[model samples]
Target chain A: MSVQSKPRVRVPATAAKGELIEIKTLISHEMESGQRKDSAGKAIPRKIINKFTAAFDGKVVFEADWQPAISVNPYQSFFYKAQKSGAFTFKWKDDDGSEYTAESKLTVT
Target chain B: MPNWFGIRTATATRRQALTAGAAGALAVLLPRMVLADEAAVADALKKLYGGKAMAEGRIKLDVPPIAENGLVVPIGVEVESPMTEADYVKAVHVFADGNPLPGVVSYRFTPDCGKAAAATRMRLAQTQNVVCVAEMSNGTLFTAKSNVKVTIGGCGG
Candidate 1:
């Protein structure tokens, strides 16, 4: 079964060539660590976004190996230099083999 | 005004003075309290990079000096890197010495990432040092640390 998740990414619409720009990302996830019990005292299987990767123009720019400690609705902010106008892709993988992806475009002047 | 040392010598015994001095020195030397998960950080470090010497600069770890809530503490880490294909940061690992699980998160970056920097929120169990270790593409490691003081609110001490 697939879960509903929304990945959000923020990148500047325009940037000067070679300018470093900040990229902010957030995803809506329950991030169940599998350590907690439900109302019926049943163990909730761990379902967390274990990995995140970002690529610009087919080149991976940033990635992360997440653990169960990551809070719900994982949010991260990083930086990337605008080398050229291209599309930035962000992907998040869950422990249950689910992948959620989002994309944004950058226009380098 | 009376000299500070003269007043301390008048009422305190030699043993008392020595004990006070030792306590003060200990407080300075050992800033962090002993926690059950103390060795977890070391184990994590060993697992990530065994026997590798980690330099103590180039990474800036930003954490609040005091946290109003331990449930959520903001953390930011920035590493000095050229972010070029020839020389860039490979990954960054974050750890909290006092948490039940010392390993917090690890971030990997490529040359396209421009700057080796990241910001996130973490759950800190108590007052402790937040450590960030950045691995360069050339296999060098740089580390930095920041202490956060957590207070249990809503109770009048």
Candidate 2:
């Protein structure tokens, strides 16, 4: 990918057991919707993140299938119940089959 | 053709049934002005439901009433559910009525997520309706729709 896209995730360090906590994630990607034309009026091929998943302790909690309409540098957020202290793995897969992964630790009280 | 003695002939009943079946399909397949404009959105919805009735509730769509710029519009969807193993939101699909393509995003949820809510940013080509549908674990579907007015184009060259 020409753009240096990086995944950023936000999670609290600690949460009460069974607490419903909101998790936020964002990645900087130059999403090409393929609807735009270049200065020469040629159609640009599509290039964007196609899938995203959030897993707690290796089990997926939430997943998203993205389309070309997603904005550039997409921002996504969801809710997760803090049951046990475990690492949350976030993955974003691109059209070129490249995957970007990030991790955050949640300490359940 | 046999002459029927009933109030309506067999051909009449058959024609009515065929018309009813084709009505929904026509609404999805018939393109207005451009190919796959808003008709694409209807097609997606029909493909997901597969002729099943979708109830109009239990889904909350949060989108701006007016978008100053169409390049970045925020959208959020939350479905009313217990989020338990027995009953939870299975998936949520979003569509834009005025985009080149109807598909915006789709999310799959599990009980471990605790809540059935997701937020994301999208690009809108113009003012249009944002459609959302949530599938429950028990195979029930719920839907909601909201409109947004955009000032500037998002996906235009």
Per-candidate Cα RMSD to the true structure, in Å, reads 9.7, 15.1
Error (Å) of candidate 1 at residue B134 is: 1.1
Q: Taking the tens digit of each residue's C-alpha lDDT, what string does model 1 give over A1-109?
A: 3458998888899999989899999998887766555678677677889888888888787888876657778888999888889999899998878799998989999
For model 1, what is the error of residue B67's alpha carbon versus the real structure, in angstroms, after optimal superposition?
Answer: 1.8
Model 2 over residues A1-109: C-alpha lDDT tens digits? 5888899999999999999999999999999988777889788899999999999999999999999989999999999999999999999999988999999999998
TM-score of chain B of each: 0.73, 0.76
Identify the candidate with maximal lDDT: 2
lDDT of each residue in B82-120, candidate 2, tens digit only: 999999999999999888889999999999999999999
Error of 2 at B139 (Å): 0.5
Kindly list the per-residue Cα lDDT of model 1 for residues B42-80, writing each as its tens digit.
Answer: 788898899589999999898899998866677888899
Q: What is the DockQ score of candidate 1, to 2 decimals?
A: 0.35
- CAPRI band for model 2: medium
Query: Which candidate has the highest TM-score of all?
Result: 2
List TM-score per model, in order: 0.79, 0.86
Worst 10 residues of 2 chain B by lDDT: B29-38
